[model samples]
Target: MTGKKKHSEGEIETVAPAAMGTAEWQAEFLTQRRLDKARISARFAGKTLDNFSARDKGRKMLVHSAQTYVSGFNLNKEAGGFPVYPKGLLMTGPVGCGKSHLATAILRGVIEKGYSGLYYNSPDLLRDIRATFQPDSDLTEDDLLEEVTTVDLLVFDDVGAENATGFVLDRFYLIINERYEGCKPIIVTTNLNLEELENRLGKRILSRMLEMCEIFGPFPEEDWRRRNLR
Candidate 1:
């Protein structure tokens, strides 16, 4: 619904009123489901841009990029008439460089903004897809694919960590390609360098990602996890 407001300068402006009643309840319900589907583990559940440790200059820059991405995301545009192809983020770096943390933080931010979001570790996502072939499995391949393709945002973590089998490559391409064709956005975190990732996921997938995403760096070489253990 919309309402008209009279301005002090004698101008009338029309504005959309906030959702109420069933609309409000339904919006919250869908938001909750998106949060659950994100499946962020306990380790990263509390990770947010505000809490992300950015002690160093590079880290601070990365955090700023993430914050800017989230702030620029427009759910209304996504749901509007025009076909909006949202730009995604690809965070590539060495092990324990906090790529996953930043990705999760971004996902949480978008989900809280009422846009649907999903998070899946690359290997775990493939395993779940493969399981759909089991006769007694509750999920079908289409079901999984539909969710990944239609969601407003998808966070795919550990991109090159999955085994590069024929089936894996086919399904991986399908998911990425579908999202690409639909103009949906995705957030990816990977430990593999460009050469290694191209080899693991193939040139086609890498090319699609390059066009669709804004690449974030080969972060600090030091392993933050190892440092924390010391």
Candidate 2:
């Protein structure tokens, strides 16, 4: 079996594999293909760290934080000779402080390094989830939940930017809770401070985040957005 059969070298094998006709196999193949495409697309998408400027002092600090996160990251690191999960980062500050820029940078870098990552503007994510309830929509609630929960790293930008209604809060909590319990990392950028996040998302969710993330920033005095206004 180690060597090719000399007699068969001239023959062309044309039979289809039996799996080709199986619906389960076909669906799995398509799902894997779509995931592969998504990973490639994410690597090329805009707002990545490379494009984010480090000119301003505040932006530089944000960049430094992101760099530190990426540099120190080792998905397979061991603790006390036992494999351990990595903690994520939580970026919270006022608007215009390069939070999203840094978060996206980290996200893109992780994806390119062979880890799955996703960036979602918090409000837009909620809106998309709501849209899926339309009569003609294809994605179920569980499907969206699974995607958010399973990504290796998730950049949840603008965490409290949306109106924190009961339904939105519930959906958001589900994703956060699942990821937290599963030891998955989530990079979150919020316009709200910890107190405000606790107020909006409640103490339980905030506590889970405290356990899972290293909190960074409230660089309240830094407004890079205003510096670029033309």
Candidate 3:
């Protein structure tokens, strides 16, 4: 289903705060910026993680999923805000249902709580990587690899939105496969159901994803966007 464009994808934009000293204040300041990363992660989770969506006189509430709890990811949290684990979240639901928001909310919240994070849609991220192929582009494979491996958190919205071309699938596999070896964490939101996910993610990635992260609730009240639009 088409989303109602209720959530602001732009909210995740964060200016990297700077620090250039060993002073306690400077160290703390840098830590705060690092936390900004996690804040973005948490926000991503809150907005996209399934919440019930309902319209009431053209207004929206953007509810949260009752079946979910953030603390359960404690092992994940204790390891490091986005632990860069082999497995990460794989949110499933209809389009415009806040799957992306959940990812965004979590990213944002975690950053706010003092952690690092990175966010991007799957296709856009791939596009950026492809652009680096140009001779004038400064980004190297190492740069692409770092985003997946070094970031505090890596968020992939619309995981399979790109056409499932062999090249695209291969690229997707490479990132996930490498991260699996490194034990990095990731967050993925998709407008696909269980069957569709099985089809799109394939058996391998699906197994890794499930092994790494818990499935957020996809209940009737889980669409936060619908609430906002109302």
Candidate 4:
């Protein structure tokens, strides 16, 4: 059905494509789904585009570019084609360059579209995994792995900031491998550029990540945090 509006002169003006009967019911269902998604997304993403501070005009422009990707995401298309998604994003830059901020914002966008997601600081995630080894800890190693591996999207922040011990590397490998094999999407933020990242994470993991992600920049600017402080 076509929706119409009354013009000032009392003429009918076509306003939009309207849904009637079954179509209207379906539209209401979709609207409710979006609203529910937005609420769930807020819980997972403590911060949002509104809180992400851009230090300069150039940085603000970069944030907008990321936002465009989030807005354009198609949940049905991604799920139907599982494991062969268009590349997810990998933002690499120096410390405090807003990498995490932008990445989280993007994840939030996807979540709002009814896809589930998770955001984790690399070191914190490792620490939690380690805790599961203690007898007193409530979480199991499998518990952590299952959640991270199965999420619609996983945002791994500060990738190269971890200690990179052998144990840590093995755990990291498991997470990456599961996601890779499942064809799940991921967004990672790191301070290391390609060369340094390749050295830190090894060629195999590096190669897979490169294949899965579209690298965004070293942003090459002062710390966004400091810039925002002023």
Candidate 5:
């Protein structure tokens, strides 16, 4: 029997008779869930570790580390066989340095391993939380917080881009602290340097993040976008 499946990009795929009721079928279902819950954007929909450019030594190392992290990921615990709290990756780099691409690729890998994952652009997440206050909105703040905190993996992209108001700070603290307390894994990407991130997110959140994640890079400042333009 043949079946049609609609992919995240709205493309249709023919599921062969051999794939039906098999591991591939299950994986397809999980992929649908990943596309919906992860909320990866169209621009990044095509990004995968295989396609990420790693021509330079620094970028090659970054890609290798990402691949290792994904391969070693465990749904019940941290990556790399750590029996302690679930550790994650903190990818710090300049804008256009491919941090988000790598972050999304990691999230995709984790989800494909039968674990649930979510990807949220930090500012967009805060904006959604704020929208919950509107009378017409369908979701509550707790609902959103619970979704992020309970996911098997969470990719929080552009960590310091949101405005640092008290409200924003409190919400961010709650999300990070809950995940930290739960020993859940989180992948964070940001352009901010250590000092700048500390200033933006405050010591409390930064401390928790430092404890929860392994630092990846202060990647070279060469902008891929600029290179593409040249």
Candidate 6:
């Protein structure tokens, strides 16, 4: 067979690596998935980093911090390797500091990564779920809770936006605690600092949240929203 022009019929196969795949492929796949999710994300008033103006400094910090938390991630990375992820984020700073913006921007990444995510403001969540308790209401509290407690990523905006009552606190705990047990990731945005957060959410919820998240502070030189308001 030497020096002979021999050709055998065989299929040229392409396989994506389960691990250490080509960076281009992985990045491309992730980008596509995000674009798909972004469509849905946009429908809900969620916008990516690009939508907001001049978040250069905060955007870099947020992305890097998210990557750090997400990389080397294990459901059991915490004590007993709780099936739920220990890594969560508390983005705190002044108003218009882009805390909520950053949370959604990360979701932009999640979408590209082809993952499930849920976004809700703390006040709206309480109102919506509580409204179901009205006797004439069609949806049951259990039904609403089930949907909420099961998302892959649950985002809470305006965390201390409302003055929470005991009922809301318990309800909030139930949802977040279940996520904790299930290893789901949660992202919270707040205008409040740690001390103020404790006063608002209370010690128990605070303890649980701290157990789950690493705090990321975005220090803006000015109130971003105020500046943006033309």
Q: Please give the range of 10 consecutive residues that has the lowest summed lDDT in model 5.
A: 77-86
Structural similarity to truth (TM-score) of each candidate? 0.83, 0.76, 0.65, 0.73, 0.88, 0.70
Rank by lDDT, descending?
5, 1, 2, 4, 6, 3
Query: Over the stretch 147-189, how does candidate 4's per-residue lDDT look in tens digits?
Result: 8888888889899998888898888889888888877878888
Q: State candidate 2's TM-score.
A: 0.76
* Clash tally for model 3: 69
Error of 3 at 143 (Å): 1.2
Q: Give lDDT tens digits, candidate 2, residues 11-86.
A: 6546666677588776666555444544323433566666778776766776777777887766788889986887
Consecutive 10-residue window with the lowest summed lDDT within model 4: 35-44
What would the per-residue lDDT of candidate 3 be over residues 1-230, giving only the tens digit for each residue? Answer: 12233347655443333333447656577666665544244444345323423454222322333223233333243345444223467777777655666567566544544456788787877787789899998889668767666675677788878887777777777877776666667787788776787698688877776775667645343355465566
- Model 2's alpha-carbon lDDT is 0.76
The 0-to-1 C-alpha lDDT of every candidate, in the order given, reads 0.86, 0.76, 0.62, 0.76, 0.88, 0.71
Rank by TM-score, highest first.
5, 1, 2, 4, 6, 3
Alpha-carbon lDDT of model 3? 0.62
Instruction: In candidate 5, list every pair of residues with a backbone clash.
Output: none
Q: Choose the strongest candidate by lDDT.
A: 5
The list of candidate 3 runs beyond 4 A from truth reads: 1-28, 35-87, 221-230
Please give the distance, in angstroms, between residue 44's alpha carbon in candidate 1 and its true position after superposition: 1.4
Residue 117, model 6: lDDT of 64
Error of 1 at 201 (Å): 1.4
Positional deviation of residue 141's Cα in model 1 after best superposition, in angstroms: 0.8
Report the number of clashing residue pairs per model. 0, 0, 69, 1, 0, 6
RMSD of each candidate relative to the true structure: 9.9, 8.1, 11.9, 9.5, 5.9, 9.0
Q: Tell me the tens digit of each residue's lDDT in model 5 across 60-138.
A: 9988888899988875554577665558989899898889999998888888887889899999998899899999989
lDDT of 1 by residue, 69-186 (tens): 8888874564466646669988888888888889999999889887888899989999899899999999999999999888999999999887899998998899899988888899
Candidate closest to the true structure, highest TM-score: 5
Give a tens-digit lDDT track for model 6, residues 1-29. Answer: 01233255664444434553568777776
